[model samples]
Each structure stands twice: as structure tokens, then as C-alpha cells.
Target: MKYKKYLSILVISVLIVSCAKNPFTGKSTMALVPNSQILPMAFQQYDQFLSENNVVTGTAQANMVKNVGQKISSAAERWLTANGYAGYLKDYRWEYNLVQDETVNAWCMPGGKIVFYTGIMPIAQDEAGVAAIMGHEVAHALANHGQQRMSASQIQQVAAVGLAVGTAGSENAAIYNQAFGVGSNVLGMLPFSRSHESEADKIGLTLMAIAGYDPLIGARLWERMSQQGGDAPQEFLSTHPANQTRIDNIVKWAPDARAVARKFGVTSFKN
Candidate 1:
């Protein structure tokens, strides 16, 4: 029975590791939640959020959010289709809304439900800037960052349970506690969030470029964001990287993004 349990654990670990892959970067990633299960939940939660929030109605900014979403969604579809992932978004109910919030934030849910805060508009400055933020948020969804996070959380929970079980009658209780603390610290946060941010930046830049928006403008958007005072915290203290780091990275990667965009006949951006 003990051997069977160990074998089962090994097999499950291998399967979990095999199931995840970074679609844009082509890297072997770790995802515990599958899209088949996550998407419906995300869509339902998104609907709930929209119903509860004050969504802008019939305004030009609201319409622009929808328009930008459609363009980015189309670009995602084309990219996925060309990469032999046709019909990947068939179940996605793409919806974009501008919310009346002072927070400068935007995010895309798993099924393509996107929300942009009104406060972000000034920083976005123009259509291209909006596209840059939208593209980044949409890239997070396309990359399944949320699902990966959920999966990681699950694994952490299982590991915690396993540790408790293994250390249940042990003389080395202190060692077990210390180990658990360290494991929890590493597993619960930090590295995974950073990875998601990086992936979003790369995929978002590519998406914006493919949507005929200048990828270079992504840097400008971040620079403006850094200038916003008061409630906004310093760059290093935030979940996102420093503004200068992001700007430099975007500038460095813009050429590659443009090259990728050219494959989709988006050789230039509208000035």
C-alpha cells in the first residue's frame, strides 16, 4: 500500500509537469489548473464583477476600450490559429468595460473579459498607449497565468499537507516547521508573480505590435505611470518591476516584436 501511494504520487507529479507549457516563450512551465476548468469559473466571476461595478456606458472611452479589445482579440486569434492552435478561443466571451475607478489598472480574465480603470486613461494618453496596456493584460490571459497560479497554489497546499503528514510523530518537529515555513514562503508567492509579469510584457508587446500599435509606446506608458504621485507606490515596492526596467526591456524587445508583427502583415504602426 505504501509503495502504491508513492508510485501514484510520482505519476501525478510527472503528469502535472507535462501539462504546462508557455505558449509564447515555448518554455516548459508549471500549471496545476487546466483551462477546461478555469475558463468557465473566470467567465462567471468576470460577469459578477461587471454586474457589481460601475461600468462606463456609451462613452467614447468605453467604446474605445471595446474597440481596442476587439482588435487585440483578433490578433490573438490570428496568432493562435497560425500556430495550429485553431479554435482555442471558441469558448471565450470577449467583453471590455471601462470602470469608474481611481486606480490606474487594467486586467483581462481567462475568458477575455477585460476591465480598464478610468484613471489609467490619462497615463495611456492615446489609442496606442491604451493598446499597449490592453495587449499586456490580454497576454496574461492568453498565457494562462491565472490558471498557472491556481495550480501552483494547489501544489503548495498538497505539499503542506504532505509535510504535516510526514512529520506527524517526528522528534524533529522544529526542523519540519522550519522547512514548512521556507517552502511556504517560496511556493505561496514571489517568483511566480515575477514570471507572470515578464511573460505578460513579452506577449503583450508582441500582441500590440501585431495589432498595428507601436510596441515602443509601451515604454512611454510605463514612464507616465511612474510619474503619477500620491497613492501610487514606488516602482520597486510594487508587484510590477521598476518603471525604468520595464521601459528598457520594452525598448530592447520592440524590434523583435515588430518582426513578429510583420508575419501578420502589420509592418508599421499608425502615427
Candidate 2:
């Protein structure tokens, strides 16, 4: 009993110590691994990933990708500085690449390493579409979702261990582990991931608007995404929100996003 109490206190202490505020969301998030350590590793892995892929270069599509990336990144920097988080992105070495692949996906690694797969370009359609995707990817990095995810996983593991230790003498120990495995994933990790996706959608919309892209295009882009039509995991089991959900959110939040951009003197947006 004493051991269990100590373990509980330790877990709580670690969570408290590792919490940090996300400037964009103004909410506390776990940061078990500091950016000081994660950034270098992320950069190294990004370089390795680039070396392994066929990076598109000197093409119009490639140029478009780079241009949109820069616009979104600059907008993010402006927002950060204005929000009193100046120098927040100083350590981020931004690199954007278009890779020749048919995955219909794009991702931004920690510290601003971004890649747009060729397959997604067709879906993106134009610079405005690209801005929508770029904004979301950049928002993920700015919000430190990756770091928070890792921290959450670490805490989940610790909790699992604590559960096992606490239930060591139970005849239903195996059953307890089985239940926890399902419950933790459904109740804990999945919600964390889904919330991140939703938050990214809202942030991305505002950033793209501030970067002079029409926020309404975000919904249209997702409409195209939904038309791509593939089997998707159920929303409750998936890490990302459903495409329709995202599309609806973008539409619903367009006016608010534009209002935010107006505060930064960005009233005009591209068609």
C-alpha cells in the first residue's frame, strides 16, 4: 500500500514538473522530452528521410510547395511574435520539400521539417489548397503536438506499470491488463490525438487566413480529400478526426479565422 502511494505521488509529481504551456492554445501540455533534445534528433531524422526519398526540385509544383510553405511559416512567426512568444521559433530550421510519392499525405516534423508527397498535390489542386495543408502541418509543429504526444505515451506507459504493480496480487491480474490496454487507448490516447487534429484544423485556418489565403478554401480542400475515398478507421479508433468533421469545422470557423487575420491587417485573401 505504501509503495502504491509512493508511485502515485511520483507520477503526479512528474506530470506537474513536465507540464509546459503551449503558447498558441494557452493550455498546459506535457513536455517530458525537451525541444532542446528532440529538435536535434528530429532534424537528423529529417535529413535521413530526405536522403532516402526522391525530392522534387526545380519544377513548378516544387516551387509552389516551397512558396506556400514560406508564406505559412512567416505567418506563424508573425503571430508568435505578436503574441509575446518572440524567439519561440528561433531554433526551428525550416525546410520544405516536395517528394515524389503517391501517398496523398503531407507532414511536418518537429522544428519545421516539412514534406509534401506528390500524391497529395493533385488533391491540393492549387496554391490556396497547398496553403491549407501547409498551415495545418505548421500548426502541428508550432503547437508542439509531437512533443506532447510522446509525453502522453510516456505517461500512459507509466500508468500501465502502476496498474500492474497495484494489481499484482489480484487473481484477475491478466484481466486487468487486458481491460487497461483497451480502456487507455480508447479513453486516453485516442482523445488526445483527435483533439490535437481538431486544434490543428482551427489554428491552420487562422494561419492560412493571416498568410493571405482564403480560409474558406480549407473546407473545399477537405471536400476534395473526402472524394479521394478510401477506407478509414472509425473516428473513435483513429488518431485524426473524420474528413467530414474537418471540412465542417473549416466552414464553420472561416469567419472567425478571417476575423483573427484582420487583426493582423490581413483583410485581403487570395481566391
Candidate 3:
């Protein structure tokens, strides 16, 4: 009993000490793995992924990807600088690429590596639409969602170990195991992921607006996404919010986004 108590205390201590502040969220987030380790691996993996894929170049759409990435990334830097975090992106080497795939997805790797699928372009439809998506993906990186996810997975593994030891001699061990797997996922991991998506939406809206893109474009982009996403799992069981939920959030938050941009002297926005 004493040993278990000490073990629990040590776990709590580690968790408390492993947190770092995310400037975008103004919250202390888990960082069990440091960026020094994560960034290099991300850069290497990004290079490898591009090498393995058919990356598009020299096209108008490709140019647009790079252009919007620059604008949004610049917007992030400007926000940081104005708010007293001048060198926040010194470690971030921004790169954007367009890949020829029909996956209808775009993602940003840790440290500013981004890829946009050709499949998502039709849905994006214009520069403002692309800014909406770019801002969201960039927010994920700025908020360190990748690092937090890795830390969360580590905590999940630790919990599994504790459960294994606790149930070693129990008659209900199998039932406990099954319940732990499902219960932990539904109660902890899934909600955690959903929150990240929602947070990215809010931060992305602000970033796009600051970059002189209309925040309303975010909702329209998602309406298109919903048409593409015929059916999504229920919110409780899924990693992302439902499309309607996301759209509602964007609609409610658009004015707030514009307010943020107004501080940065952005008086007009592109639709």
C-alpha cells in the first residue's frame, strides 16, 4: 500500500513538472517529450514523407499553398511579437507543399512542415478558404497538440500498467481489462482529442482574421467539408467535433476574431 501511494505521488509529480505553457492557449499543457527531440524527428520524417509522395510544384495551386502558409505563419509571428513573444518561431522552419492525392486532407507537422492534398483544393475553392484551413493546421502546431498527444499516450500506458497490477489476482480481471480499454478511451482520450480540434478552430479563426482573411470563410469551408464528410462518428466517440458543431462555433466566434484583428491594424479582409 505504501509503495503504491509513493508510486502515485511520483506520477503526479512527473506530470506537474512535465507541463509547459502554450502561448496560443495561455495554458499549461503536457510536454513529456521536449521540442528539441520532437522537432528534429518531425523534420526528418517530413522530408521522408515528401520523398515517398508525388509532391506537386510549379502550379498555381501549389503557389497558393506556399503563399497562404507564409501569410498565416507571418500572422502568428506578428501576434506573438506584438504580445511580447518575439522569437517564438525561431525554431520553426516553415515549409508548405502540395501533394497530388485525393484524400481531402491537409496537415501540419511539428515545427511548421505542412502538406495540402490536391483533393482538398476543390473544397477550399479560394485563397480565403485555404487561409481558414491553413490557420487551423498552423494552430495545431503552435498549440503543441502533437507533443500533448504523445504525453497523453504515455499517461494512458501508465494507467494500463496500474490496472494490470491491480487486477492480477482478481476474478473479474478480464472484465476490468475490457472496461478499462473502452472506458479510458471514451472518457479520456476521445474528449481530449475533440477539445484540441475545437481549440484549433478558435485559434485558427483569429489567425486568419489577423492575416486579413475574412473569418466567415471558415464556416463556409466547413460547410463544404460536411458535404464531403457524409457521416462522422458521434462526438463522444470521435476525435473531431461534428461539422455542424464546428460551423456553429465558427459563426459564434467570427466577430471575436475580427476584434482580435482590429488590434493589429487590419481594417479590411479578403473574402
Candidate 4:
């Protein structure tokens, strides 16, 4: 009982001290690890990834990746600055790379390292589609989703250790630990990830709109994605919002995105 009390206090203390504000969501979030430590490691890993992959350069597709990344990132900056968070991205070293992989994936790592897989380009079909994808990927970075994910995992591990210690000498200690492992992942972590994805979708829509791309294309892109016909796990067990849910959200959020873009003098949206 004393161990459990101490564990609870420790968790509470850590939670209070490890919180950082998410600019996009305006929510206090766990940030167990600081960016100073995480960014260097992320940059190194990103560099290593580029070295290991077939990085396409000087091609039209490569240029497009760079171009869309720039526009989306600039839009993010404009929004931040207008909102009085100027210099918020000073530490971010933005780099966009096109990789020769046939996977319909694009991701932005911490501190603005982005990679777009070749297979997604055909699905994008045009520069506007590319901007939608780019805005989404960049939104993940801008919103610090990577940092939050790492922090959540860190807390989960620490809590697991606390549970193990608190359950020590109990007759059902092993059973308790096993249950915690499964419960924490399914109940805590998966939901955290899915929330981040949804938040990214919202912020990305605003970004693409401010960058002069039609935010509705995020849904159109996903409509094509849904037609790709692969078996996916149930939404409750998945890290991303279900396809139809995302489409509905994008459709619903389009008017709000345009309203935001209008604040930045962007009245025209590309089709």
C-alpha cells in the first residue's frame, strides 16, 4: 500500500512537470523527453534513412516534393506568426526527400524531416493532391505529434514499471503485470495515437487551405486510398481514424479551413 501511494505520487509529479502546450490544439500535453535530446537523435536517424534509401533527386517528382513541402511549411509559419508564436520553428530544419519506394506513405519526422514514398505520387495525381498530402505530413511535425507519441510511450513504460513494483510480492503479481501490459496498450496508447491522427487531419486541412490547396482533396485522396482494397483492422484497434470517418471529417472541416485561410489573405483554393 505504501509502494502504491508513492507510485501514484510519483506519476502525478511527473505528469505535472512533463507537460508542454501543443500550439495547434492549445492543450497541455506530456513531454517526458525534451526536443533538445530527441531532435538530434531524430536528425541522425533521418540522415541515416536517407543514406540507406534510394533518394530521388533532380526529378520532377523530387522538385514537387520540395515545392509542396516549402509551401505547406511556410503556411504553417504564417499561421504561427499571425497567432503570436513567431520563432516557434526556429529549431526546425526543414528537409523534404523523395524516396523510391512503392509504398503509399509519407511522413514528417521531428524537427521537420520529411519523406514521401514514390507510390503515393501516382495516387496524388496532381500538385494540389500532393499539397494535401504534404500539409498532412507537415502538420504531424508542426503539431509535435512525434514528441507526444514518444512521451506517451515513455509514460506507459514508467507506469508499467510502477505497476510491476507496486504488485511485487503479491500472489497474482505476474498476472497483474500481464494484464497491465495489454490493458495499457489497448486502452491508453492506441487511443492516444488515433487522437493524434485526427488532430493532424484537422491541422493539415487548415494548412493546405492556407497554402492555396483545396482541403477537400484530403478526402478525395482518401477516397482513392479506400479503393486500394486492402484488409484493415477494425477502427477501434487502429492508429488512424477509419477512412470514412476521415473523409467525413475533412468534408465537415472544409468551411472552417477556408475561413482560416481567409485570415491569411488566401481567398482562392486550388482544385
Better of 1 and 2 by TM-score: 2
Q: Would you list the clashing residue pairs of candidate 2? A: none
TM-score of each: 0.86, 0.95, 0.96, 0.95
Model 3: residues with Cα > 4 Å off, grouped in runs: 1-17
> CA lDDT, every prediction?
0.81, 0.91, 0.93, 0.89
Off by over 4 Å in 4: 2-16
The residue ranges of model 2 lying beyond 4 angstroms of the native Cα positions read: 2-16
lDDT winner between candidates 3 and 4: 3
**What are the runs in model 1 whose C-alpha is more than 4 Å off?**
1-18, 169-179, 182-188, 229-238
What is the Cα-based lDDT of residue 152 in candidate 1? 69
lDDT of 4 by residue, 1-271 (tens): 7377548956685855577887888998777778999889989999999999999999999999999899999999999999999999999999999999999999999899999999999989889899988888888888788888887777777777788778788899899889988888788888888888888999999999999999999999999989999899899888888999999999999999999999999979998
lDDT of 2 at 33: 89
Q: What TM value does model 4 have?
A: 0.95
lDDT of 1 by residue, 1-271 (tens): 3234434554566566636665576866666667788888988898899889899989989898999889999999989989988987788889999999988899999889899999899889788989999999999888878877777667666655555555666788579768877756554455567667878998999898889999999988888887875574454345566677788999999999999999999867943
Worst 10 residues of 4 by lDDT: 2-11
* Candidate 2 local lDDT, 127-164, one digit each (tens): 99999999999899989999999888877787778778
RMSD of candidate 2 to the truth, in angstroms, is 1.7
